[model samples]
Target: MTRSQALTLKSLAIEAYQPGQFEKDLTRAEAARRIQMLRDEIALADSF
Candidate 1:
């Protein structure tokens, strides 16, 4: 996914991790995927 999409997902993931959970529609696996995507982006930026 593009960075924007990943960012949106990451936000949702963060919210989901909260006491009430982030996205009511998103599964744990999906949250993990978003986290991974963000991590990948960070790693790419770090390498630059």
Candidate 2:
């Protein structure tokens, strides 16, 4: 993931643990999907 995407993911994670730091919300499945997407993105980039 790029810097921005990583930041968003981090914010989501913080919300998961702390539950109020971020305004935007994601369900458990949504968060899982986004995390997987980032993993895929990073893996693909590293393959270059």
Candidate 3:
């Protein structure tokens, strides 16, 4: 797998350490930033 994809998965994995936990308190901007980063990583991976 590409580095970008791997990193994306890693970030998600970290965020999901305890399901439905962080989801409750994360602000809109923070969540958007994290998800946007994941999407960018996916796009980078797709190029590989």
Candidate 4:
């Protein structure tokens, strides 16, 4: 993943309350998918 993507993923993980060390071997696409998933989770939780 690019530095920006990694940072965004980390931020989203924290916001979703799922913070942790991520695998370094993740592909860019995988990182993007995870970031979007995290955003969705955070949005869903906030909608409650």
Candidate 5:
């Protein structure tokens, strides 16, 4: 994965562990889904 993608995934994983720190109410599965969506968005973005 690209540095940006890795960074994004890392950030998401951190949030998944401490979501309340960001005032976000996300479950682990939801956080994982969000990460997948971020990856998909990055893929689509790179297609441009």
Candidate 6:
């Protein structure tokens, strides 16, 4: 993944409280997917 993607993924992971869940060598698509998933999870958590 690109540096920006990696940083965004890291930030999302940290926000979702799953900082260790991401892989270091993910593809750009996978990173984007994971970031979206994390954002969804955070939103779900906030709704409770």
Scored by TM-score, the top model is: 4
What lDDT, from 0 to 1, does candidate 2 have? 0.57
Writing each residue's lDDT as its tens digit, candidate 1 over 1-48 gives 445554566575455443333344555576667567665665666798
lDDT of 4 at 28: 97
At residue 12, candidate 5 shows an lDDT of: 55
Decoy 5 TM-score against native: 0.48
Q: Residues 1-48, candidate 5, lDDT per residue (tens digit)?
A: 444544556675564453333224555665556678656666666799
lDDT for 47 in candidate 6 is 100
Worst 10 residues of 3 by lDDT: 16-25
What Cα-based lDDT does every candidate model obtain?
A: 0.56, 0.57, 0.53, 0.83, 0.55, 0.88
Question: RMSD of each candidate?
Answer: 9.8, 10.2, 10.5, 1.5, 8.7, 1.1
- lDDT (Cα, tens digit) per residue for candidate 2, span 1-48: 355544677765454453343234666556567766656666666799
* TM-score winner, 1 or 3: 3
Error of 4 at 11 (Å): 0.8
TM-score of 3: 0.49
**Colliding pairs, model 6:** none
Q: Rank the candidates by TM-score, best first.
A: 4, 6, 2, 3, 5, 1
How would you encode candidate 6's per-residue C-alpha lDDT over 1-48 as one tens digit per residue? 889989888998988889985789999898889988998999999999
TM-score of each: 0.47, 0.53, 0.49, 0.83, 0.48, 0.82
Q: List the residue pairs that clash in candidate 1.
A: 15-22, 16-21, 16-22
Of the candidates numbered 1 and 3, which has the greater lDDT value?
1
lDDT, model 5: 0.55
